[model samples]
Target chain A: MKKVFAREEYCLGCKLCEVYCVTSHSRSKDVVKAHKSEEITPAVIIESGENLSFALQCRHCDDAPCVRACITGAMQKDPETGIVKYDENKCVGCWTCIMTCPYGAVKRDEYNRNIISKCDLCSETGEPACAANCPNNALVYKEQEEEGE
Target chain B: MSLSLKNPEFLIERNYDRCINCQVCERQCANDSHYYDEEMDKMLSKDENCVNCQRCVTLCPANALSIRQYPLEYRKNSNWTGEMINNIYKQAESGGVLLTGMGNPTPKKIYWDHILLNASQVTNPSIDPLREPMELKTFLGRKPGKLEFDENGNPFPLPPQLELDTPIMFSAMSFGSISINACRSLARAATASGIMYNTGEGGLHQDLYQYKENTIVQVASGRFGVHQEYLEAGAAIEIKIGQGAKPGIGGHLPGEKVGDEVSRTRMIPLGTDALSPAPHHDIYSIEDLRQLIYALKEATDYTKPVSVKISAVHNVAAIATGIATAGADIISIDGYRGGTGAAPTLIRDNVGIPIELALAAVDERLRREGLRDQVSLVIGGTIRNSADIVKAIALGADTVYIASAALIAMGCHMCQKCYTGKCNWGIATQQPDLVKRLNPEIGEERLKNLIRGWSLEIKEMLGGMGINAIESLRGNRLMLRGIDLNERELAVLGIKHAGE
Candidate 1:
């Protein structure tokens, strides 16, 4: 499957990926309206320093740890997409998956503490919003089949 | 002790309803124009700090930001305008010459707008570029007066030439003035487009040495990076006498911009100012210029063409003739509205002449002296579009150089704050944070797209003129007519009035 990857050298640390990701995951699917009305929490997190930055999201490992770490059976790895999918209703808000995530791609809902926030790579949108809206092309959505995995 | 007289030039407006206090604008602004007030729980702006580069406005997710010219006006006097008063106030405060970036912003007469191109009528049908094989390829170098043959009927080798896929080139913009990314972008674009890009006085960086075939290394008065390897690495060498932005003046690259790479490339001490003196101290006369040109020719073993670049001033026609006679293979003339990283505002605004007249005059003079074929004419300073390229060819130019347009292709908003060393667009700054904003891959792609688009437009125009090759359009003044120009202006441009 194609995945989202970040070329950190070109990242401008503008956090525009977060803005676009939040807008894509929002109810209204509008930039201004989603940023203004809804509580915005982007699935993609930008790890930034004084002069360097890169977007971080779920790597979707073949042997996903978040799926195994979920206590309430809320997290499950979809066999087809190799994605660690999250079910909000089945979660007990114990934050076990957040602690187990080595990449720290998991986040808790700010308003509702019952569920966890994670990345689905915007499956319905075909391409990740962060990669699509990147002004510098630092984030790209591509297939890593050439890696010989 | 606490008195000031200058006012802010721009006013920043933000829509509070749309702004969620995301702080993106605050973080993106290199000028620190926007800040979040903890006490008021609102975003505020320091409009005075804004140079109006539009980075914040473009990056604002909510589309809530807009910049407007500050409505500060004078008491209805044309003699002492607001800018004039503000300039006086700034000089009174600093006691230093006013410096600006970019080209002249005055309402100067643009000859390109006054001139109109020709199209084929009922007599000769215009060729459709889409269906026909139009030729835009051009070679810039001296053409031998006559072909010599040996006993075997094999002709002697022609002079070295710079083959261009289009009649446009990225003009000289040094690395110290712009970021390395910008340089790399232009270099990559030039290499991809089969054109050339000049390395303005700043020595060629090590990474760009791979593109030597598409490079035109320049040796200015400073001779910053002029060495054997550097001279031989380029396809051609250009002796830069003056620039259009500030003719007859020197250049200064501040100490802070001389980083390790720039220091290594320019052969200057780290954190030391790179100063280019006004004139080549050794070049006192045309004879002196000829000696230098010959020296360069000798250094390159006469393999690379040597070009002489000068500002379009009052006596440009005579000067160009002298340069051609000095054995220069090419003569590049820059008009008054050219670009610069930093120049005194007075010189940039009031120094040089328009290139249209200068080009016409130089072509006329060279032809009169029977030296036209001995050298190729390349004009620059402000080549805005494909139409400008077509018009320049019709005005007797082999090619046109474009710096500001190329910079714009790589994302230069032209805020005129390049000397500040804090360019947010990553085109004219050394700041790593800002410089990384310009990805060379993206820059290269945008520039190629620009060249491709312009080449298409050029072919369409050439097809409309009933010309299949760009060389046929050179010095074809019959295809151009003046719109609102007087007889003297038309005569200088060597073109007739519209009705005529």
Candidate 2:
């Protein structure tokens, strides 16, 4: 399955990915409206230092620990697409996946303390919002690494 | 010890309703103008710190920011404008010379706009550039006066030349003055576009060695990175006696900008100001210049063309003659309105002459003295576009160097805060984070695209004039006519007034 990838060298560290990620996940799907009204946290996290940065999301690992760690069946790896999908309804405000996930891709929703937020690759848009909105080609949704590497 | 009696130059207005407190503006501004207020639970701006680079405005996702010139009323007088009063306040506060970045921002006469190019009339047919082939290739070097063929109809050995597919080349902007990514952008673009990019006074970086075929290494007064391998690494060598921005003045790269890379490349100690003296100590006369030129030639084993770069000043024609007679293969004259990393405001605005007038005078003087073929004229100091390039060639320049335009291509917002080392667009800053803002890959693509667009326009203009080859327009003053120009101006430009 295609996954979102990040190249640290090209990352500008502007966090537009985070901004757009919140917007795409919001009901308005408008930058200004979503940012102003909605309190959805950005599923993608930007790890940045002095001159280096990379936008990170769920790896959707083959032996996904989030899938195994969930006490409730809210977090499940899609058998077809390989995305570690999150369901808000079934979540019991469990912090189990957030703890079990070694990559720290899972996070508590800022607006609501109970539920969790993570990358779903923006399934409706057919590509993740973080990769799509990156000003620089830092984040890219690709099937696999290029043929060379 | 003293309070500044100055007003904020710009006002940053943020729309509170649109602002989502994303803090992107706060993150992007290197000046620390934007900040998140914990007390207010919102984003706030410190307007005084803003240089009006628009990095925050451009990156503000919700379009919540806009900067405007602060409308501070200081009892406006025509003679003592706000600008003049502000300059006084700044000078009094700092007690130092006013330093500026980029080119002169004054409203001086632009000769390129005043002069007009000719198009083919009813008597001649203009070719369609899209349908027909056009030649823009240019060669910069000393000519053999006339071609000499051996008995077997083979030409004899020729002087070294820097062959370019276009008459446009990236002017010398040193690495210390601009980021290495900016340098890499020009280097990559020049290589891709089949043109040349100068290494300026700063030494060539190690990564740029791969593009040596398109490089013109420079030896300035400071001789900052001059060595055996450095000399041999270029397609040509340019001796930078003077720059157009701060003519008759030396260059100073502040210790703050001399990071490890710049320090190593320039062969200078870390954190020491790189000072290039006004005069080359040994070059006191034209003869002295000849010795240095020949010395560089000898050092390069006569394999590369040596160019002497000078500022276009009063009696520039006479100086060009001296430089040509001094055995330099190419003469590059930079006009006063040129860009620089940093220069005193007084020198930048008041010093050298315009390239149009200088190019015409020098070309006419060389032709009159029968020394025209001995050197090629490469001019810079504000060749803004394709029309400027065409007009420059018509006035006798073989090639035009573009620094400011190239910087603009690489996303320079022209904030003129380059000396502060906080260029938000990343063209002029050396700070690692800011430097990463301009990815050389993207920069190279943009620069190449700019050149590509300009080349097409140049060809179209050339075809409209019924000229196929760019060289055919060389010194063709009849192809140009001055509009709204007086007698002395027309005389200096070597062109007739409109309807003459």
Candidate 3:
């Protein structure tokens, strides 16, 4: 399973992951235009503590609570890739996924308050933009064997 | 003529391209928004039945479903808002009062954001928490009135204290309000973090007895399952006179939620209404409160400190003085924006004073009365981040209690739907299927991470202030300045303008 892991100790709290995420998900896929003109909301958020900061995103667990708690079945994990995905079309905007995501990874898409948005591992690029753009490698995307399998 | 009601809130759409005639949405929807059409071999939906919970969306295998808010707009009238009209219609239909949960969501001035912290620039050297020891350790209890030495030059005997490695504590979330898994997560996290978690009104579960050293069992008006053994199974005891969410009111756990497990935990009859009284009938006066405090001390043999929790009201300073004089070792003040399992919407949004003003007033009053040293102040309402904690300490709180933040860490979305007992996140539900959604292991890890993150941030803030210990920050309003506050607010907060 491919998952994103946060190494909080190494994080600089720069929030580059958030910036890259917005650009990657932008319609034009241009960083400057996405930031300057577009109203973009990044899927990843960076939280800073006393002397430390780190980026947090969806962990895409094998058994995700968001999927279970979602009353309308808007949140689902891919059977093949183990990627936790959001179907905006199926979303009813109840915010159950937002409540169920422990990491606070799922967010209300500002453009459409009715649909919850989250990290999709940047499926188009085959790798997460946040992990790729991380200056300190604080966020890493890696594939691992299933625990029981 | 009867007014025409608004249209259904949500619009459910199903794509036939990928759908293989599955009926999972029909089975998963608690609101019964979906149903299978046997004759057509297809799925149909009723928009009015859906509350947009998104359960079926997550369970769908074909990934061909979508739901959106109905794009129906009434004639725009700023004076008559949609919510106002909808609420009026709802009340007209049901003839019942609105009930809500969690903290207040209405936009209001958050004092923590207006206040700015001062940092050491040149003269005072900033201490690096990484290199030097930054003491977040705190002791919650009555402090000695004076420093006295024995004949052998030993310090005087100290009162009972709840020692913590950090000043942050996980606030109250009763077992009945939240699931056992949620409580277990908090218990394990408290033990691991060397802090404390309160068993708010709800009696402690027997399985959590092992974490008694880090637990704060409460004795609310309901006295749900408070017994001799329950009193002794905690580091301290909190007498909950009121909660911040719904001040001057009681909590009601519907009979439907009073299942066998909740019944056993609360020591109440199954299917009985577990209503906590608004006031402790015995505590009519300060003297009466004192009597209860002493009674609890005697029950625990003076081994545990006694805390009195009250909502922040207009006369909070005077109320705090009475509580302190009544011999409460710790006085916990909950602000207006505190969370609750359930509360009347009217009371939750429009009652009680803010914690910031209340904490400042109480601290100033206690100090002026020369009784500040006798008790520890633990404040809560909406303590959101580490900066807020630092701000609280500067405002004179010994430590801060956190409930909503901790719940968020455990997967609460602040949807204010807890009163419905349909909390999909599992933290505030009694339903077996829903409650199982919260895994204790994951909950604990998330809580630990949140606290650890906050601790690091707190230490860094301390370092910026050139302070090495949290004690130095307590009651030090000089370290804080109000940026946008007026003269009255600044005076009330006891802080100067940011530029001043």
Candidate 4:
């Protein structure tokens, strides 16, 4: 499975990743106004608590429960990359996938559109934008076999 | 306005009643602004020679003294504000970006203006740049000792020349820190100007490949975005030993700024920390530097020239000698006041020596060692105008590189906040929208215009000096005379004070 790993030690807390992620998903790509608008919500949020602050995003799983729990067929695994992708067109405004996923990867837009949004692995670009722009080399995109085998 | 005697020693005044004598002011002044004249039994001021860094005023324990213009003024011209007149002239000629190098070129008492250039009136005929063909072109690379010819009478082998159409070239700046747009603009400008733009320590972007002939890629300590292909993709390779700003410190591109494109170019994973080590791990001694230089030479099949760039430190003469001996084709010396995309404000303002002193010392050392012509010299940091360029050449530089000046031509305001990456001028920011605002076409044209303007002025100055060629001015120290300089300063510069 392709996973995003963070070397939390190297994170400088610049928050550029969060801005990029939000812009990539938002309709306008305007960072300052995106947070307040109900139509768009950032797919990834940086969790800040006590000495640690890190970006939280979907970890595309091998056997994903979000895909199985989607009653409206909104979530599905790509056969090629095993990446769980959320389709807004078929999402049917249900929160089943959001409540059922073990990793809480599913999130809704600010407008209560009921359409789920999650990390799509940036498969189109071959590398995650969030991980690409991190200055500290704190993030890496690698397959399990390549990383371990 | 009343005119006081412009003696260098009597330029300052100190109020002892207001003076706490805490010595904080003395400690902060890099130019020794405040000193106790033991024989005179009073504190003294060295105001006339001060560069006006203002460190002493800000750090003074008691608000005892203030340094201001010595209250001398010329008749004011109300018809045009200085900035307005300059902007009008800049816009009229190029319809391009108003590119300039060094600090603000506003109306200041530039030392060059006070020193006049002599012309040949009775002895030699003055050549006009417009009518007579003048060669403003400069080649910055090692010259071969002798030509080698094959059996067929064809020259067998010789080093390639960094054929710059003009003497001006873009100085080094990295890719990861500066936006790709800025790099692209520099590449396009360099190509158009028939000059070269250095890649700084940052690796080259794939998109810049089209302008490879005009690119001078740099290999800095961080080795970020460097690979074999990256090494071969430039007209010349520069090994960045030091930068004028923050000379001894390494660069840190905060992870936040390491976008995917930067990470990809740098060969590091995206979003990871990109740390440029302080010094090259592979290079230790001069011999080690040679190994790296030869290694690059081998990598590129000796097709490209290798330049070594270093900051002008106190021992720059010795360092430059070592670099020349290390088989570098060119030696670029950056002075202390050089500009940078991002460096600690403290380091940028405090470190390194001035180019004037460094250049003279290096030239003297190289000439003494019988290796003056072994390497080409390119000096930068703060080369403000054509006059400074001529002065630099006389001090032994073959050519000069400019960065901050170029950026200003491309609309950089010099807000001194390049590290934020939210540069309003789009020269230093990575934000896509801001980057696009620079418009590379205008940037390129502006740079071309700036160089063209400077080249004409340089030719005029050289012609006025009774020297028709730029090369004739190089290392001709007899042409310079230091004004208002002490004996030691004059000795170091290898020139006599005016009226000596």
Cα RMSD (angstroms) for every candidate in the order listed = 1.3, 1.6, 13.5, 18.4
Chain B in candidate 2 has what TM-score? Answer: 0.98
Q: How well does candidate 3 score on lDDT at residue B309?
A: 96
Q: Of the pair 1 and 3, which is ahead by TM-score?
A: 1
Please give the lDDT score at residue B156 for candidate 2.
88
Candidate rank order under TM-score: 1, 2, 3, 4
Indicate the worst ten consecutive residues by lDDT in candidate 1 chain B.
B19-28
Off by over 4 Å in 1: A146-149
Looking at model 3, give its docking quality level: incorrect
Clashes of each: 0, 0, 24, 23
Candidate 1 lDDT at B447 equals 98
Chain A TM per candidate, in order of listing: 0.92, 0.94, 0.89, 0.81
User: TM-score of the A chain in candidate 3?
Assistant: 0.89
By TM-score, who's the top model here? 1
Question: Per-candidate DockQ versus the true complex?
Answer: 0.79, 0.68, 0.02, 0.01
* Interface root-mean-square deviation, each candidate: 1.2, 1.3, 17.2, 19.1
Model 3: number of backbone collisions: 24
lDDT of 4 by residue, A2-100 (tens): 677765544434455655565456565454334335255556656655545567678777788888888888789988878888888998877888898
Task: Give residue A44's lDDT in candidate 2 (0 to 100).
Answer: 89
Local accuracy by lDDT, each model: 0.92, 0.91, 0.86, 0.73
Q: What is the TM-score of each candidate against the true structure?
A: 0.98, 0.97, 0.74, 0.61
Candidate 4 lDDT, tens digit per residue, B1-500? 25433333224456676553435455334356677666866566777655443445543434566766455433577767544454555566546543322332234233444333445687777777776667777888888777889999999666867998878889987786677877888899898889999988778888998899999889989887778888888999999989887688777787877888888888888777778887899998999999999999999999999999999898999999999999999999998878876675446655677778888899899989978777899999887777888888887889999888888778775645566666544577676534544556667778888988999998887776677778888888777877766677677778766665
Minimal lDDT window, size 10, model 4 chain B: B99-108
**Can you tell me the DockQ of model 4?**
0.01
